[model samples]
Target: MRRNWTDTVVAMLVATALGGCATSKDKVLPHGDHTMLDVWNQETGGSAGGGQPARQLLDARQGLRRPLIEADVQAAPANNAAYTRTAANEIYRQFHRLPNPDLVMYVLPHLAGTDPVPVPGYTTVFPLYQRVQYAMPGERLEDY
Candidate 1:
């Protein structure tokens, strides 16, 4: 069979052009034509009989904590009073502004078998939304 040099050259050029389109800053790329449920199932943590794999859980928690720790270090409050004062001022400003709030405070009681459980393994406090989404009612969250 005769080799098609023109077709080969065209293919190489197209490949190079496509490669150039991909930037170094791409942390994640779209998974083309996959439904949300399909992606969820693919990423579901595999059950290991009684519970999840300890190592995998620890890794996930550590991964989550890394960015938060970095942010905390960068935000380095001079003291507890300074941190509290800053947070309180932000909360007051939001309160003054009504619906648009700096923080959404939620208190959820940990329960085990229908009773409020103690912290030593029965239940623990899970703080959600330290990063507040400030938005008016009926407004899209992504708008802000």
Candidate 2:
């Protein structure tokens, strides 16, 4: 009888522990016929119950389109010759080059270390090209 009581207590403890590990299925219900689009329409007051036209609710600028008149057009300045010439020149302008010219450097030799040893002098020039680089075809000038 003592052994049976011990076994019964052990079985009850094991069952309680396993039950605690099990998850509730009530909150995990499957999504039925309703989809994300239906939920959005309901939230935005576009459903039939709201009494608002669904098209107007979906597009806020439904009736805002209008034709431009002469008053809406701004007049161009009479003296646009300079502006036109500048604009024409700008069409061929290459603005991506380095502003400063390439530099030439000269290194002088000297003796150094605990024991004095002679080092030879050298000269070096920069900018391997003679002219600055131009914007390549189809290259984005704004990136420069």
Candidate 3:
């Protein structure tokens, strides 16, 4: 039987309304007298709950985070070789942009419409190629 879409939607709406009106107010979770703050305080050792105090926990964490010094930075050369390069070296390593030589054009002086007012000639520059090109990583990109 081909049921009208409007009738199907109305039936679904009625079913949903009836489901929402059901007298099922049963508790799904066990009763708890504590607020979320109370649980958080207990876990994080806040003043209201018993645990490691927040200050002492922070101190312990801070102690583990040893600050990096010049000597420390120099010590990990082998492990951090790839990461240690200056940003300029990193960008030009693989996908260096092929040089886009500029094309300089000189527009000759011309007369304007209706009134023969002379327009001054001007020089303009454009890139030789339509779009920028990139050299493949590790490819020889020098002038051949």
Clashes of 2: 0
| Winner by lDDT between candidate 3 and candidate 2 | 3
Tens-place lDDT digits, model 2, residues 14-119: 9999986785665556567878877776666655334455556646665666776765554444345445666666786545554435678888997878899887
Scored against the true structure, residue 100 in model 2 reaches a CA lDDT of 39
TM-score of 2: 0.36
lDDT of 1 by residue, 1-144 (tens): 236988898899999999877756444564568777655544554332323455576688888873457667766765455546565666644312123434344445545566766534333344354444554533433332
Regions of candidate 2 where Cα sits further than 4 Å from its true position: 1-17, 28-33, 44-59, 62-66, 69-101, 110-122, 127-144
lDDT of 3 by residue, 34-132 (tens): 998988887777879665677778788898997899888887876687656678766655676888899999999999889899999999999999998
| Backbone N/Cα/C clashes per model | 0, 0, 0
Candidate 2, after superposition: displacement of residue 137 in Å?
9.5
Residue pairs with clashing backbones, model 1: none
Which is superior by lDDT, 1 or 2? 2
Better of 1 and 3 by lDDT: 3
Residue 32 shift from truth in candidate 2, angstroms: 6.2
